[model samples]
Target: MTTPMNNKNSLLVELFVEELPPKALKKLGDAFANEIFGTLRKLDYLEAASAKTTFASPRRLGVHITHVREVCPDIAVRTRLLPLQVAFGPDGEPSPSLLKRLEKEGATLAQTTRAFEQDKEFVFLEKVAAGRSLRDGLEAALHVAIENLPIPKVMSYQLESGCELPGWSSVSFVRPAHGLVALHGDTVVPIEALGLQAGRETHGHRFEAAVDPVVLRDANSYALQLQDEGAVIASFEARRAEIARQLAAAAVKVGGGSVPIHDDALLDEVTALVERPNVLVCSFEREFLEVPQECLILTMKANQKYFPLLDAQARLTNKFLVVSNISPDDASAVIEGNERVVRPRLADAKFFFDQDRRKSLASRVESLGKVVYHNKLGTQGERVQRVMHIARGIAEKLGDAKVAAQATQAAQLAKADLVTDMVGEFPELQGTMGRYYALHDGLDAAVADAIEDHYKPRFAGDELPRNNVGLVVALADKLETLVGMFGIGNLPTGDRDPFALRRHALGVIRMLIEKDLALGLDALLQDAAAQFSAIAGFDSSKATVELRDFILDRLAGSLREQGASAQEVDAVLAPFPQRLGEVPKLLAAVRAFAALPAAAALAAANKRIGNILKKAPEADAHVSELLLKEPAEKALHAAMAEVVPAANAQFDAGDYTASLQTLAALREPVDAFFDGVMVNAEQADLRLNRLGLLMSLHAAMNRVAQLERLAV
Candidate 1:
């Protein structure tokens, strides 16, 4: 250790441990570095322009920080003591209580002063507190950083027999830490953590390091030294980029426009597993290509962490790429070893695929009765029956008998694959395997496609179903989940949606709005709820209402995400439009109408008319031509006669944009009516007629959306 100084210098810290979980390494590395940096900054040990670079590897987590201070500046503090009356006697002299407090605090009466706190006087002590040195500050920061790491699960182990606490030798951490390094400039900071003392040495690349213990000269030389002597890439991002570059180059060397399957999650996990990456090309027997590319690709990527190459037509090739942690003079042995390891995995996939086809999906439907889907919602067989009924109803509403029959068949076989061997080995291939098996059974191509696509739009931005049969089945499947879950009162609260109810609701909304389905949302939900009526004491009314609100909420959010303004969304959605498929048209019409020159005045008048009609609850939209008394009312009635008819016709024809624009023509006459006429007239007949006329104008202006919601 060197003598303490106040000069700014770079800092380096490392925690060497056993292999961390590959999936969680990135998050763990970031959290560890950020926690330390935040604590130091809060303690005033960081300069204004301090920066941090994170390092994560299979065996270590480290950080390099710039412009860190060795010691913080002393701070001035004013501490509140007892009340004035309690701190002193009536003689106006120092009391025994005040003397004891001052002595304990290492202060005298000279440092005491009076201050008012909440209308009561109290004695305050003014003093300057000493700042923390780098060694002390770093120790505290390390303890805090370790305590806050987002470890998926922790392991507890007994430390060596000679730890700091003799007989109390248990140490618990994400992994048992072996070494701790803390450096400031050229000096060791002398901090300790996890039963280890700070040092200027760290090991690198367990198998390929040029030096067993790489000695550090200073904080800035850490990365270069580790690379030159240790044969490791310390930075996570740099290593991932290098791996990606190598993968692309190797793919090109195959000379068939081949490219590695791109997956960020796979890349991240592979990066976490390797300290020094070496990409090599390998191949398997051509006979395995008979299996679906999805099964083969998933097996290679999920089990072996390999990248399956795709040909120019985006078909999986027999060859794949492997990222090995070691590199030797002859890479043939490494390549051959990877090929040997992957062949058995591919064989297993092929075996499962071949065995699953021996029995038809229809024959396996009864097995679903024994497999429980949810305790309250019965088994998989029961759920399939519900989905089949819902799908047939939706198809019938679409007015195509052939489509209704195909959808019913598709829904019946959809959940049958849940009991298949292929799906049991890999749960992600549930719907995918169903489609292949359906095709094998000589089902219609449309029905086969629907068997796979009922689970489409599985996540945000995912594609919708491919055909009409698929769309009908998808809608039925999602509605079954929403109605069943909400009816059982298993609602999502805050951020904990264990059942993925939010995603299901969004899927239903997307199908209705994007596919332009003509079914009313209320009726579809009612049909879904009816399937649950056989259960004892089930109430479909409350669940239907709540489920409708949930779907509408999801629709409003989806519209906003698609670039609709909040005010526009509110205007269209406030009326609770049951035909969700018409929302986009209504929103478009509202947007177009809002852009007109007379739109502002008309919207303001509509809002005023609504408020007036609210007070006169007896008002109706029946206007009487014989009872027009004022010129403004007569002029408004005349404008309605010419424009309202065209607007009503355009609206009925589904030309919503033209209809709203046609209503814009009433703005001039409507403004004159509101400015000159009193809707609440003295005579009962005149007041009722005037209210009726205003009500008619209000009705004509707000057919597409609630124009008053757009009012500023």
Candidate 2:
């Protein structure tokens, strides 16, 4: 494997196997490539800045790394030996322990003793080792690369009689391995992987290949040879781009100026499923369009791996694009075959929709009892009742009887679609099908819209609810989940939130803060807990605190994601403000206050004042005029007397930035008071008076935000 006097060369490694799991293909490819590339780079066989390309097809995973050396460079390594005390005896001559260490290090007495004495603390043996050959490094790299693959599922299969045991030769991998190829430029590296000797040959498209096993010429020619001779596009990303471009072209040829469905996961899955992708236009019966576009699109993408074309307005059309592995002279058969295959899928969706609509959404409410929400939290019917109670209270908080009635209606019918055939077939369409059925049931549009939008902002960056009714019900639904889950002690631990409690909490936070709903988070949680009165083993008082902290923790993360520094968010969130809507304003106030010239000095003074107040005698914000002895104390008192009232008024008027910025005016007097006067004075009256002044200043500075947290 040492090629042409150990010159640098591009390297290639390919492992041909059965089709990989589509979802895990990208990760598996990346992990395998990085593992091999990183180990070689660490050993100095490849540089950090070398160019590498990862290729993942349905049947193969490969990597091509440039600027890889045939032999790694020699390195000097220091090996630690015994401690300093053992290196020398009391007689000051070379100790017997030192001589044994020197023998193991293969060093002379004079040289080893001189080198060891310089450091003396710990004896370190130094040696210049020869670089590794490419064959040896590649063999080790292959072992590591295969072992570290992020395989979603592993299989145990029999190998072809290579093991030491008599009748037991088995290999476990993501898929059954067939061949291994390792090339340094044009040279074949002498190594074995998965019981297969290294070779330049790999199988390509099983049916359409020009040759049985594509013979790769060199590292640089692998992709081109696969494409030209083996009829396969070996690069995953290149094949994906080609499929996308062809889909767009095929949609244009259909004359509707349509666009294929834009789903990244679907695209990635299809890319993993094909070697040579030929996107062809296909169509289903136009009557299938009467089914919900989501149902058709999902069935096409999920089951058939087809891209349903949509018009410019993003409405599904009858036409779709199919990525074919074998590009026949006429793709008519492939197109019709896919069209035939998808017809039954679309028919089933239509059947489910029709069957679901024959009965009203209201009729499905009682069936929710058959569905167990959680063994501890009772059934879905009971959960609906809890959500209904919370929703009604929120609606009443918002307005009169009309809003409350609508909210009640929406919350009651919210989970009814869970029992519908359409939703049962496709669990993802739960809330969506509910909306369609509600509208079909002659319910008000607002009620129908609420059913759909209740699950809004389902994931990050998703849209929020459409209207106030939806907002209230969404808040109630999420609150009920949090409260019930917490009451049952099903709190989320690290990476194990089976109920997605964090998402539910963030959803609730998003609705409350975004809608500026008048309900406080604590009030909402308390009401939700009350609805679970019949539940056993529920401790509402404790659960409510946990719920508040969990939601506020999510809020801090959300705030940080929106560009608020951790310090600013901590300052605003320390008090856990009642109106979460005002949190953004408070953060803005902190940011604005922090930008002020006196803000740092004021924050530090506030921190010092807080410490002083904590240690001093308990006192309210009341000062004795006669007890003010120092000039700085009198000035701070006068400044606080003026600033506190104005700041309090601004806080009451909802100008948090103005409130916090106004307190910046007292920075000079605060600095003077801390520098010139002592709060723990000799006289009791003076000490209490100074403490009172500091308390008043501290309270004023922290009303809008916790200024002490802003202290460096």
Candidate 3:
């Protein structure tokens, strides 16, 4: 609690609680910061030079505010009065009773009376409200903010006994609030109304200095005290730097050499798990290394929250690093305990791996029938059959019969490992486990890799399929899930994606574009819809359309993410066929075309032609060269004829920018024809022929894009 050199206001709130879950701690810290600031803004109490800071540990959540205004700014308020004619007599004199009521209501002297519409008059009343003290505003705001802290699960202590807490407060937070500290410079602000007392004392790490509370004389001193006596590094950046230095030193000491500890998630978790981190290296049995490296590492990380180490070759080492909250007197004992806990888990994994190998990979395919994919979509076995059909179609289109057969076989066994004991225990290892089992059973290497790589991009920013077989199976898997869900009407709504269909759709798009694999999504989806319809008894066409639209939405989002403008995307999609791989090329063309100076003029010319055709009568609109009379029309037709071949050639070579340039050459001729010609001539034959010429221009423009749709 630092003393204010000048008169300034501030707030401090601290919540003491039992141990909080690490995951919930970060969420609560963010929620409290946002809620407090929002409440202050809503009440118009936010003033110049305000700062808010939040700190959280397993046992406590605290927030501090500094340089807040001592009082809110004075605000001007206005009140509108009904027409004076209605309140007063026709002679324009106020009624005696009305004047008395206005005075009683605290109405200020009228600033002016002005004539409004319809012979009505309005009177205005204005006043300036005096500011309130910071303490008064914060006291009211604290009550509202505490109630709004978004603690989904809460409990109540004995404080509200016999009195029903409001539904909002009935829930108790992960930790109960012990007390609050409110400070205005060096002065302690009294806040007894909300069961809190302003205090100058705060605690440090429970293990190192339990009950040794430091009296915070000022805001600056409070921060310094925690650092010196409490051994608490309040800043996240300082803590991270210290952890990295300790980890590097520990890794160097372990003779196996320093391994890149690639654990950003673990780093974040460990940072939140402790205020003062003690990084130590611990080793396990070398015999346990024989177990699958992934299983060992995942078990250590997932169960014990340890960071796995890798050797120079990027192989998993037998050692791990654990970040603890307290520096131990005997560090070796902690290492021994962690090693003991990890051994049993690794032993279980090794056992499951050996037991699963006794059966052939082919035999496990039967177990998929018992695994439900979705309630309405039948079993995993049935979905595999659908994937097999889709994969075969994709393979045939790619002209790779051998790869298609291999993909079909891989899809059949992909989900079979879901029934394995190891995968049941660790859901993240579904495809990885399957690939390992297939290889152990002497399946083809390609088939085994396909099993694993088909699920490559499980989420955004994840890897995509590396082989054609994997690519086909990946497409099939995503298509089935999307089509089946849409058929059953389980589409994702705003903020509610139960099935993660969006990820699947985006994964499919990335596989096609990034890998440059040419596959027609519309055709594949159509086939999938048909298969689902036949098995489930519904109209497949509607499902095909819905699924296509869903995928298109994802494609649009992906394109936008790549920096394509909204209008450019619409321009490309307008003429491009709905093929997964073609979208990337179309987008490229649109981007290139948009950069050309001619593109704007071409778009304007097309829009003019379209507008003219909209007004022309549908009857007698066929182009007949014999009916043409005007030289401007004849010249425009010749110019279009000359550019058509060049435009088509440029488009075929994927040079859309060149094609747009060729199209723009017609713009001048088009303008001249419109300037000199009357499209709706008295001669019906001439009018029809002229209209047909305009229609031809519209069609040519549409070959590149529906320019009207590309309007920015």
Candidate 4:
């Protein structure tokens, strides 16, 4: 090891471990680096212009921070003592408590009395405390960062006892750690963790390293040194980018415009699995291609972690790419080994597909009884029956008898693929395989397509269901889940949503709005709840209202994600617009109306009107012709007679923006009425009349949205 630099230098810390879980490597790396940076900065070791670079590989997580001070400067500290009143008495003598406190702090009465000042309410003392050593700070920081890692699961292992006959002691971490390296500038920081003392020694790739303990010379040279001598790409993102590059180049070599499957998650996993990435092309027999490409691709990716290459048309080619940890002089053995490993996986996929096809989805329906959807909600078979009934109702509302029958049939068969062997192995292929089997069983093409598409819009920004049958079934399926789950009090809380109710809610919202379905939201939910009416203690009324609220909350979140501001979303969604398809138009009207010169004043005036109406006696919003004694009231009344009709006509035609703009004419009259008229006159008739006029105005202004919510 080299001697330490005197002043500013880079800082490096590494935890070398056994192979880490690929799924959590990125999060673990980010958390570790941030924790170390935060700790060092708190200790005043980091400069303002310093930068932190993180490195992570299959075997290690490390960070190199520049501009860290070798030693923190001395800091001035003020210690608060007793209050002046308690430290001194009116007789101008030190209190006994003050004497004891000063003695406990190793301060004399004369010095403590000098610390008291008339300007300060509390007596204070000052001292210059020596700064912490880098070794001490790093020890605490390493302990905290390791303990705080966001590890999915931790393992307990036996570490050999120091200076003994290989006696074992237990330790717990994400993985069994073997080495730690903490260097400041050119010297070791003398930190210890994970039952090991810090050093400049860390091993590289298991096979391809030029050095065993890849001796890191200094903090700033860690990355380059690893690459040069150890043959390991130490940066996770850099290695991932390299893999992506090689995968692309290998795809081009296939010569058919083919490319590897574009999956960021798969790319990250592959990066975490290898220290040195060597991309190789391999192939299997084309006969395995007879199986669905989804099945083959899923097996290749999920089981073997291989990326299947696809042609320009998005069809899977027999060729695929593997990311190997070793790069040998000749890669023929590695390529052959990977290819051989993947063939059996693909063959297992084909065998499952073939065996599943022997029985139609219709015959597998009886087997679903064994699958429990939820303990409280009964079996999947029971839920399927409920979905089928709700789908028929929704279909009948959307189309004729034939359409309704087709929808029920699709819903009946949607969950049938859950029992298939291919889907059993790959649960993500549920709806996809159902569509294929439906076609094989000679079902109508519409029914087959519906089986596949009912689970569309699976996530945010995903596509909606394709056809009318799909719309009906998707709506029915999602509504059944929402109603049943909410009925059983399986509501989602802050973080836990075991059933993915949010995704289902968003799916329902996307289908309704994207398809522009004319089905009424409340009516659909009520009908869904009524199907479970026979179940003991089911309340259709309460469930409908709760389900509507739950879905509306999801709608607000979805609308905000689509670029609607909070005010715009609140204005449109506050009333729980059951005709959600019309919400876009309402928001557009609100946005356009907000931009007009008269919007703010009108919004304020509407807010004033709402406040006035809420406090007044209960009265119908009807103005008696005889009670319009004030000129402002009569003028506002005449204006409303002209504008309300035209605005109502526009609103009826779905010209929401035009309707709101027409109400802009009310801003002047509204301002005059509020400023010139007292809505609460002593005369009861006059007060009622004014309240009525204000109520009518409030109703018209909020037809498109709660315009008052836009008020500053």
- What is the Cα-based TM-score of model 3? 0.90
Q: How many residue pairs clash in each candidate?
A: 0, 0, 7, 0
What ranges in model 1 sit over 4 Å off? 1-8, 81-126, 165-168, 595-601, 668-675
**Model 3 misplaced regions, further than 4 Å:** 1-10, 41-47, 77-127, 160-171, 192-194, 234-241, 595-597, 611-622, 680-684
Candidate 3 displacement at residue 486 in angstroms:
1.9
* Residue-wise C-alpha lDDT for candidate 1, range 1-712, written one tens digit per residue: 1212333399999999999999999999999899899989988899998888899999899988888999888989898878999898999988888888999999989998899999999999999998879998999999999999999999998777665443346788999888788999889999878878899899889889999899988888778778878888888998999999999999999979999999999999999999989999999999999999999999999999999999999999999999999989999999999999999999999999999999999999999999999999999999999999999999999999999999999999998889999899999999999999999999999999999999988999999999999999999999999899888888999999998989999999889988888899889999999999986656686569988998898888888988999999999988889888899999999999889998888888888988999999988888788899899999999999999999999999999999999999898888899889888889988899999998888888778899998888
Per-candidate alpha-carbon RMSD to the true structure? 3.7, 3.2, 3.7, 3.4
Give the Å shift of residue 537 in candidate 1.
3.3
| Candidate scoring better on lDDT of 1 and 4 | 1
**Who wins the TM-score comparison?**
2
Model 3 error, position 77 (Å): 4.2
Question: How big is the positional error of residue 129 in model 3, measured in Å on the Cα after superposition?
Answer: 3.1
lDDT of 2 by residue, 440-530 (tens): 9999998899999888779988899898888888888988888888888888888999988999988988887887877787887887889
Pairs in steric clash, model 1:
none
What residue runs in model 2 are displaced by over 4 Å at the alpha carbon? Answer: 1-8, 79-113, 116-126, 161-168
* lDDT, residue 283, candidate 1: 99
